[model samples]
Target chain A: MSERRFPWEAVLAFIFGAALGLAYAWVLAPVQVIDSAPEALRAEFKDQYRAAIAASYAANGNLTRAQSRLALLNDADAYQSLSAQAQQLLAAGQTRESQQVAQLASALQGLAPTVAPSTPTVPIAATSTQAQDPNAAATSTPIETETPLPFYTATARPTHTLIPTPGKPFELGTQENVCDESIGEGLLQITVQLTSRRQLPGIELILSWSGGEEHFFTGLKPELGNGYADFNMTSGVFYTLRAAEGGAVVPALTAPVCPAANGGTFFGGIRIVLQRP
Target chain B: MKRWVWILPALVIGTALGLLYGWVVDPIEFTDLTPETLRADYRADYILMVAEAYQSEKDADLAARRLAIFGSDSPAEIAASALPFGRENGFSASEISALETLVAALRAWQPASGAAP
Candidate 1:
């Protein structure tokens, strides 16, 4: 009987040992997995942040400090301080801003065109001179009639100078490509011979007059480097053009105007002649 | 009685196998990311890219930046801006609308720093 009891006791001890071992494998083993989870997530979050920064810079050519903040998601303390300037700029409306902060917040993000307009098609077999200015004297003209009989009469069309319309703003640039939408004022009517796309930095155009309300046009903040704007000036004001970039203004062009300001800013940086009604 | 004792070992082995399966392969059910999530990612990328470009290249000139991003104004400039925009944002209708607004605003804005005519 005693021998029988010993075997039963041994069986009970074996069951208790197996239970303890199973508990360790089931509970303790998964704890390690749980421990590694946050780290893995943190790494993935970092990758997402970097990808965002790279995309933003590639699209806009500049990064708002706020964007940089988003990239540093792991460092919330640093993000708050660094993004202050960007927040202020947005508040001040200096930069074109978006309503959403993160893609996770909404489904409608990135619906805009990824590319700008396609290149315009130029006419085939067109000569440079003809293509540039067909009105030049060297271009072909209709033959003159010899019979003085008709007492030729020529109607003269008056050439009108461009002046800003009241309450309208003028910007610099020419026109929009067929595919891309035109931003800002498009001086499509005026022809500009574009020389350089770069800005003439440190120059400011000031409105000076002998007697009138003080007016000025300075400190250009470009949205996308497509075009810029200038104020319409009244006749008899001394107009001084200056370039300003990186926070300093430098003189670039100055003209004493006895005439009114030209059409709303011409795109592509060209001289434009406005028509009078 | 001794033969039945073997049952204990088998039960223990089975439990161990179950635990291994649960820890390694139990929770990995497949679920794809939705199209909506992808769309959100795309939008986030575009806005952030535009904002960055405006700040750096155009010196924060909204009009010029828009032109650079949208490629409006002369075909040549448009082409130039287009490559960048396409490579980054790809052609989309919403981008076109944003470009339109930018052009309108710039055209109407009389810069404090007068741009040469």
Candidate 2:
């Protein structure tokens, strides 16, 4: 009968252990889930983060490049007193210091719009609203009203010259619309009418440009009854334009009129206009 | 009777301790970013981090944003949508340049590609 007694000490110890375990399990574990978050969402965050950094660097690099150019322009005596090495750079023609100077200047000036909103002090929600809803800007008075750059509308008409003309690649051209002046200093609005000799079913035209660095704009849907696409630009910057199809770059069917080297059937033209902003 | 007195308590205690640790410590150890447990749990801080990075507009922001985005396994649609946020909230030239590098890095990473990595 004595041996058949309830094990009071053992029972108490068991209860104590169970309680402690439960406490640890319930209280401590949840914090981990709260910390790491979901993986898919994590990836999204990373991508945005990267893009932000790249943009910052590019903007700053352009700013520095501009300041350097300004310094050179200020020093005429420096140019006159150039060493043989400096003179060689000028003669090589490979380094267009003058053009570079102009580009850097324009880039720096253009950066104002991008830079103002980028300040860390500014609330992201505020800027985000402004972007998603242009009208949302009215709710809060902006730090400063932006002087909207006037945009000019231009018409581009394309005329197909010859297609499938054996080695001639397709060709097309449109008369330049010089009737209206471009708006803003050093601005160029190019409206091009594009067409193919034959209806290449399921074909789309892609236009890409390399300015300060490679920039691309795709999905140029054809215009009504006329295959047309328009691209905007600011002058004094180097641009490389290409016509692409089926995920490949090909020469333009029609000759480009502006930049001298774009004369061949597949070659496109480059234009640089000097205008006051 | 003597065996039952100690054996039963020890088993119960051991089980309880195991359960407690399993519920608490195991999850955290499994999910943290430590090399061994990298995949134990998914993380979503990349989004907030990127957003905050853009808000900063400092040159460092761009680089930070890029680094955050490139290392994750986010969806394409979400990635595409985030671009305008970056553009409108533009930062200094250096920051923007960093963003460019970040884009290039993510582009090159090309994670698994279907929808989400």
Candidate 3:
């Protein structure tokens, strides 16, 4: 009878072949990805994109485009995301970048584009001179009128500057305790507007309770109202809210107590309205 | 000897299958992409954004820093490349002007603290 032997050599060869195949697959020729959407960017790169958007918003005060650009990230809550990012930046000692982001957040919070008609897109293309940059003129591509992105028009529009470098100072117009159970965990809602009732954004405020002080801005939640901002409050904590450095001060503010649909009680909220005196 | 005859063919077949799977069946999906890989049109728009911000800030250094996110391109060259794309792609003339201004600033820019090598 012929002696049978294990095919160790053939097995070894197959193993070698598989190893070579995997190396070639994983390293030598990996696939190339291009034309990726902004949403697909890595976390750090997304933050970078957000920073540029914030800076552009600061430069032009075009909240609409800024919001649209931010929407590309598909953040669950753009305002909260921005505020959190600003806080992160501040913690990282990137003070100016933080402020830029915070300022944009505030202005965006206050704008009610749907109702205010504040940032209307008026084309500015006609204002441009025929002269182009020599370098750009030389290497121009074959021009095609492609409208880019969602809701973007081909023409450049004049910016409606919402937050002047230092906008008009505001004084407390009204501070009321809203004992409503529906506004979620009780809010310290603040509304800021011009004397003419135009919602004012970019107004800075400081909120302090016994052991902690936090600074926040208006227009961070424009859907609520442009020039509107709010913070959550704990049931028993007393707080003091002030605008700018020495502007109007509202003291001894706290979350109110309200009747719930069930036989239970819920925390209420504070509503503070600020306007130019 | 019979098994040995199949080893080279097996290796070749394995390599072909691996290449097909890697390049076609399941191409590597990127979860962490930098701005350098942005689509041509989107890249142009991002450059336009930098130009708009430059128009507002008028700080070439900041513009350069923002442009630096592209990883490889010089700020001026990056901004310059966008202008032609912007012009041909329906970016308003004023937007084109903004791109021009940014490119000029980047070209003339010198580091404030002498970090240039």
Question: Candidate 1: DockQ?
Answer: 0.07
Lowest lDDT block of 10, candidate 2 chain A: A157-166
Please give the range of 10 consecutive residues that has the lowest summed lDDT in model 1 chain B. Answer: B30-39
TM-score of model number 1:
0.22
TM-score for candidate 3: 0.55
For all the predictions, what are the DockQ values? 0.07, 0.10, 0.34
The digit string of per-residue lDDT tens for model 2 on B1-117 reads: 474668566657755775656675553332213211221111111222233333333223233324433345333333343354444543233323334443444444444441111
Candidate 2 segments exceeding 4 Å error: A1-43, A56-252, A255-277, B23-25, B28-117
Stretch of 10 with least lDDT, candidate 3 chain B: B108-117
Query: Per candidate, chain B TM-score?
Result: 0.26, 0.29, 0.73
TM-scores, all models, native as reference: 0.22, 0.24, 0.55
Sliding window of 10 residues with minimal summed lDDT for model 1 chain A: A127-136
Per DockQ, the best of the predicted structures is 3
| Docking category of candidate 3 | acceptable
